[model samples]
Target: MTQQGARWTADQVLALAPDPASRKAGSKLGTAGPWSETGSADEGTVWGLCKGSGSKPYQTVVDLADAAGPAYKCSCPSRKFPCKHALGLLLVWAGGESSLATVPEERAPEWAAQWLAGRRKRTADKAEQRAGQEARSAADPEAARRRAERRAERISAGAAELEQRLSDLLRGGLAAAEQAGYGLWEETAARMVDAQAPGLAARVRELGAIPSSGPGWPARLLEECALLHLLDQGWLRHERL
Candidate 1:
């Protein structure tokens, strides 16, 4: 599990089932009847031997340390990511099924131990990769700073252009806006998109939507215009902001 990972809820366990039939099958097997030697480790591993139609019992192991979610391995014939037995094992553990017992982390059986080793290696590799990325990013500080400055300048220009458009709309009075429709706003928004100011472009698109809005449109228009002016002022005072 990743650091401070949340425990899986019962719904989350069931959600892993590939189908409703699998989920039902898994839920039924969640009790202690078909399982033996059930054990969980503090380090987030669960394992059990499940009796099957065959003479031999199937081995099921779940490694909950996976950052994405618990991972499963079952010697049963099912091809599911978590075979029914694995799901049953997790569900049983979740239900506090009487068969299970807690043990020290190092007490994992050989099969589970092998899986845990692989999980640890994969986790270590990911951590190392992230560390390398951070190191490289730190090494190129000046380039990152220049990129940020350029992006801020583009946003500032976009904000200024949007401010001018809003001023023109107010002077022309929004009543005339019924005739002068979305084309003007779409063109302005496209320019903002070209300037790489997605935030401003999104606001412009919202403004374009106001005319077609059936009721109390003038109020909505005024409110949106005020917000546009706020963005303009924010960019003008970018250093303080």
Candidate 2:
């Protein structure tokens, strides 16, 4: 249905009733005979006081701007969501611009005003919460990107250092590796660990075992060194690959 000063028909108002009893009871009180202080405010809200059997009249209000159709509030003791009083109030408002209860007012009474204020505050709080979650969601990807870049830098530095160490080892001759023993390989692997290159560190540990493998150890050690050197070059030029 249309909103903002637009009025629903009597049939439409009754359609919102919880049951036949509510529809019937609401129709009976739809007239001006038992309603007072009735007024429609901005934002599709209508409120009024209905004379019940009690000393104090029942206060009823309807928020027509609700996305799920009209929302209702009544000071009655009924368990129904849109009680008869609220339905009756809507029916009275459905009478259109000429109805006594449809008179426009700049503000609702204290009771109605309080309910409206509470609803508005809740809605604003929910909106603010969603905005905060969205902001954090937006920041998370950027933080992840920075972390990845930092890791890449560490790996590249490790690879370059490894390449230089391989060059020095080859210049010093393959015979020097056997004399250097496991200590040289262990120290280099530890350096790779500091650089956050676990794969390189593992390969370095494997190289340390080759010197003790027996028979043609020099050829095996040279082959492993060639492979490790190729891996270091690949990492240093990863962007091109």
Candidate 3:
């Protein structure tokens, strides 16, 4: 079946954002004038470059047909969603700057190539591994059950530890967490990893930022906590799935 075209718009682009900082940064960079060029190739890749604040301009490229969303990398220090650079580049592309010639001779930089290759390889490997696992499970129901049980046990232990940590954080209050710094979250995340729950560990690390992230941090932290709780609950109940 054929797929639908992307509904690209400034509002749609901004809605993909998860934070206000990214929106503000995107607005700032969007004023840097029109893109030099924009275009989509036969392979479904959309590319564009726009002027940035520094001496070097920002580059943005997206595979509109890919379900994984756009790939973005910028020289900016802001860890905000899409970043200002990405937003600016997308703005130009979504506007009327998408008629540039194909530049076949322009090769990707070593770093970009390496990163892209690694991502592709990792995704391919994961798919292959999952397929293999499914095939094995189809042939061996007992083995699959044992694996599921083990995973459930590990997840349970990780959830318990995370609950304890959250309780400690609440008991001490948000101010204490700020004084504890990133090391506290890193250490907690490490513990979560050791418990075989890397996903939970990642969320824990993200939660560490709330204390130092200015006003309304409590609300943000609570939201993250609720997400973590949901993850823990889901894993505990749906391990077989």
Question: Highest TM-score: which candidate?
Answer: 1
C-alpha lDDT score of every prediction, in listed order: 0.76, 0.77, 0.62
The deviation in Å at residue 38 for candidate 2 is: 0.5
User: In model 1, what is the error at residue 62, expressed in angstroms?
Assistant: 1.2
Output the better candidate (2/3) by lDDT.
2
Pairwise TM-score winner, candidates 2 and 3: 2
TM-scores for every candidate against the unseen true structure: 0.56, 0.54, 0.50
Q: Which order, best to worst by lDDT?
A: 2, 1, 3
Which 10 residues in a row give candidate 2 its minimum summed lDDT? 97-106
If the candidates were sorted by their TM-score against the true structure, best first, what order would they fall in? 1, 2, 3
* True lDDT of residue 236, candidate 3: 68
- Supply candidate 1's per-residue lDDT for 182: 48
For model 1, what is the error of residue 31's alpha carbon versus the real structure, in angstroms, after optimal superposition?
A: 0.9
lDDT of 3: 0.62
Which has the higher lDDT value, candidate number 1 or candidate number 3? 1
